[model samples]
Target: MPKVTMNINGRARSTEVENRTLLSTALREKLHLTGTHIGCDTSQCGACVVHVNGKAVKSCAVFAVELDGATIDTIEGQAAPDGSLNVIQQAFKDHHGLQCGFCTPGMVMSAAALLKDNPKPNEAEIRDYLEGNICRCTGYQGIVNAIMAASGQAVPAIAAE
Candidate 1:
């Protein structure tokens, strides 16, 4: 067993895990971060997304040992400093971005990372960037709208700014 340490959701954690243990497993099983869902064993689903060192990554594709000493942010850490919903999460709720909600956590995490880097992404850019995320329920239009709204854009009746 390889003992790995990671800073998750602003807390430092150390776990003795198997060498091949996936990051998603470490999060859900060890740290109990169930908000990061495991929708697929394959990495193509993007349902296990989380921020590793401030960038979004598919948790299913990453090994715990590889993330040793890295800083990770799960959906639980996305809340505002006051413990209120973050802009992206609020936008998702306001825009009806989720249905079954299985893919929502990953979607929000990915959008948060995207908005962190590019605060004002256009519609096409938003679509292009979200190609990796797969939403099984909402048909994706609402997700795009939510992200655009959260990024501070004047779209429809939504007050993005």
Candidate 2:
């Protein structure tokens, strides 16, 4: 076992984990930040996306030992200190972006990262950016609408048949 220390959600945490322990495991099992979901261990699903040093990375693909001294931000850190939902989260709720909610954390994380880099991305960019995150229930229209609304863009109307 190796001792790894890092800043998680503005708090410094030190834990001993196996050398091969994935960051996702350390976050969920050790640090108790289960909001960072693990959908596909193969990295095909972006459910475990989290910010490492300000860049979103799939936690399932990274070892906890490899991120020593790094600053990690999980879905738990996205809300305000007073517990208010962030803009992206609020948008998701308001736009009905989640159904089963299994993928909401990852979607919100990816959307937050996208909005952080490109505050006003177009519809195509939003879709392209979130291609890695798969949601079986929402069909992604609501997610896209939420991301668009979070960026302050006008959500395009879905025409009636």
Candidate 3:
């Protein structure tokens, strides 16, 4: 077993995990950060997305040992210290970006990464950036609107329907 240590959500966390332990598993089972869901172990679902060293990556595809000493940000960290929803999270709620809530954490994480790289992404750009995220509910209209609203852009009445 490898003892992996990571800076998760601005805190140093250490866990003893097997050689084949996936980052998602280490996060959920070891670190007890269950917000990073394991919707697909094959990495196609994008439900395990998290920020590894400031980049959005599907946690299911990465090994926990390989990321030892790296900085990781999960959905648990994407909020104000006072527990207030971050702009992106608030936007998601206001826009109804989630359905069933299985994919909400990853969607929010991906959206945060996109907004970081392209703060004012247009509709087409937002859609393009979200290619990896799979939202089975809300038909992605609310998700798109949430991202736009988070960027301080005007969200069209797309969520009004």
State TM-scores per candidate: 0.93, 0.96, 0.96
Q: What are the per-model numbers of colliding residue pairs?
A: 0, 0, 0
lDDT of 2 by residue, 1-161 (tens): 89999999899999999989999999999988899999988998899999899998999999999999999988999899999999999999998889889999999999989989999999999999998898978459889999999999998799111
Q: Across residues 58-107, which tens digit of lDDT does each residue of candidate 3 receive?
A: 99999999998899999999998999999999999998888799999999
By TM-score, the better pick of 1 and 3 is: 3
Worst 10 residues of 3 by lDDT: 152-161
- What lDDT tens digits, residue by residue, belong to model 1 across residues 1-161? 88999999889999988989999999999888899999986988788999999999999999999989999999999897788998899988988888889998899998988888899998787777788889988458778888888988866554333
List the pairs of residues colliding in candidate 2.
none
Off by over 4 Å in 2: 159-161
> Cα RMSD for candidate 1?
3.1
Name the runs in model 3 displaced over 4 angstroms: 159-161
TM-score of 3: 0.96
